[model samples]
Target: MPIYNKLVRDRIPEVIEKTGKKFHATVLSQDVYIEELKKKSFEELEEYIAAETGAEALEELADMFEILHAFAAVHGSTIQGVEKIRKEKEQKRGGFNERIFLVDVED
Candidate 1:
């Protein structure tokens, strides 16, 4: 199967019928899509920052922007609008350093 294929509500039911197995598939309505996207974004961040193992910083950061774009759409903002805001923020509050520098403390 190809990664990152688009799915629809009807295909979900068709899959269920063909498989003959009970699998829960969530169909996010327009309203629920927004709410769920926000919740999922935070959950992913928590997993990245508040957990034991190291999370791929690039992958998680991409996920954050993916959800943020979805959020922009939900609120009727275009990509240009989002980009403008991003640039504004970058100019006002600079971007992060690419290097991950850490100081170790000795006991």
Candidate 2:
């Protein structure tokens, strides 16, 4: 059996069981869960970057979306709350829609 020491989605164990595969998993402590979430986010981001097709990119983005929701819940907030903050920041500064790149800023 291949060893996977990383975090997985909640239903992964059930999925594996359906394939008659025995696996080992443990519930992470609060601190460890948070750390794993951060790590998972990076993993998902890397997958997204490597996606060659639009559908594959979308699938990876959905995984990242799920991770974001889990992160919000762990921090005692909802996706709506995070969106609100995002909107506020967008209104104050701006968004990436312009595709502007800053090469240098001299004093």
Choose the strongest candidate by lDDT.
2
- lDDT per residue (tens digit) for residues 19-105 in model 2: 998889999999999999999999999999999999999999999999999999999999999999999999999999999999999
Which residue segments of model 2 deviate by more than 4 Å?
none
For every model shown, what is its TM-score relative to the native structure?
A: 0.55, 0.97
CA shift at 35, candidate 1, in angstroms?
A: 1.3
Lowest lDDT sum, 10 consecutive residues, model 2, at: 1-10
lDDT of 1 at 101: 56
Q: Report the C-alpha displacement of residue 19, candidate 2, in angstroms.
A: 1.1
Give a tens-digit lDDT track for model 1, residues 1-107: 33322323356667767988665456668977767777778866875675554457666776677777777888899767989998999899777766655598799
Clashing pairs in 2: none
lDDT of each: 0.69, 0.96
Clashing pairs in 1: none
